[model samples]
Target: MALFRTSIRVFHSSTRKMTTSSVTRAPFLLSPNQVSELTNSGHTHSVSLLDSTWFMPNSPRNAKDEFLSKRIRGAQFLDLDEVASSHELGLKHMMPDSQTFARACEKLGISPSTHVIIYDSHGVFSSPRALFMFRSFGHENSSIIDGGLPRWVDEGHPLDTAAPILPEPGTYGLPNLKEGAIKNYDDIVANSQHDPATNGHVELVLDARPKGRYTGTDPEPRPGLSSGHIPHSYSLTFNLFLQKHKTKTGQEYSTFLPPSEIKAALDNAVGTAEANQIINGQRPVVTSCGSGMTAGVLWLGLQLLGVKQVGLYDESWTGYSMRPTSQIQKTS
Candidate 1:
């Protein structure tokens, strides 16, 4: 029993620190000052070449940063959109398989310990989604650079336009099997009616789709998926918290967000008109979306906030939206 207890502690410790290496991460992300220490002499380690909302367009390229022509030296470029969808059109940019992720990270020179920050050409569209994905996939040390590239460029920070050189690929070894931090449709369904056989508690479901889609006002972006949200799930668009676009230019990608600012976005969202949930202390979250892909983003945020006992509604709106109205929400 003593041996078993020690082994269990090690397992718990690993899960807790899954996103980190020997390097310690600022809890979630503190004020920008916390990481300002990263600027030793003049350099950032593991920078992202994202174009999140804050990047400025002092020149024509600044608009939407659509070209990503002004990236930081040594930064890795992970496409803000379609990293997952490029191959499996079925999953709307859901977390790609481990092998696929490995290849992409390898191509980008990301490692288990890389400090990842995702920004978009627009302040809000896809960067937060990517940051959330990294967390769920177990890169705990990652952070969103505050204000992203626009802020940096506006500050007259240096930008590099050269194509990124490749680094030796690092292992992106996410397991294929669902583990402690993931869940599927049946898991939700079996527990939907509050079954005592499993005697396990079903989690609170969170829908990351647009409010219009959550309430059936908007058609799903993907074809054939049903329109409504899952039973008990509430809608909250990740983009609502993203920074506004500075221009109408085509979208490219840049890098980073301020942790304090992102935290504020989340804080203001609780029970607000833009967001539909009032997450306090109770009711552990189970994130969901049209096809279970974006839901992972929501799940990722909750994990960052230190919510334990969370899971993903794997089928999300797609599987449940197709169900007969009578079967949508099962009551005990």
Candidate 2:
């Protein structure tokens, strides 16, 4: 009996260690100060800072044009619409397969060993989505710059106006991608509804669109797609996680609110019990929004609140709304 018990103990101990390593926690978000510190500490070589700004088709200012004109010194651009997305027509900004993703990272001098730091021109918009892409690709040493370029400039950091000197192409090989870090329509479809078998392990679908969009009342910015959110998903606008601040020059910009405020907002969106389950890591959360851009905002907010099992619905409502078989719900 003693020998049998000893074997059981060893098995459980080894299992725990494996589980711990599998879910390694690196810093989720970094301030501009920390990024500057790392640069000054002679750590620039291993770090790949990404400018992952994106704009809607109707937006007047082009993200790429803005990057070429002015960007954080030593920041490479991650083209979400062109490089990292699926090649399929009309599926805007969907996550590419592993090989395509590896190639894109390689072009940007990002190898598996690279420490990626993402930020966007818009304070807290698309960088977290880029971070999600990197993490889903199994690159563990990834983080987002808090407040992004707007805050960086507000703090009097230097910007590079000249053309970027691209680094030598990196040898980013195939990675052990984390399947659970991104969810497809099928996964959300399967897991959105509650079931007794998945009592404690349910995946909560969270919509990051505005209340009007969530309720099918607002017209979708993208043409030809139906309005309304996925069934069993809660309406939580991505902007709720952001707080606007004015600079010394009287320019206004948005930045992430403190974790406490974020937690309160999330708790209100999803009920207290469900939010607690998600925060305690008992349940998973999947975030989605129009064309998968603002979904990152919610994904980052949840990460700030220390929720681990969170994912981005890469296709978001763009694909869901157009699908003939899918069902959408609206609340009055």
Off by over 4 Å in 1: 1-23, 26-68, 80-89, 171-178, 194-200, 239-282, 291-297, 300-304, 319-332
lDDT of each: 0.49, 0.79
- Encode model 1's per-residue lDDT on 52-169: one tens digit a residue: 3322113344433444466644555665334563322243455565676656766666767565655444433445456655655666555655445554455445667876566666
Model 1, TM vs. native: 0.62
- What's the count of clashing pairs in each model shown? 20, 0
RMSD of each: 9.2, 7.9
lDDT score, candidate 1: 0.49
lDDT of 2 by residue, 5-25 (tens): 111211111122211233323
Query: What are the models' TM-scores?
Result: 0.62, 0.87
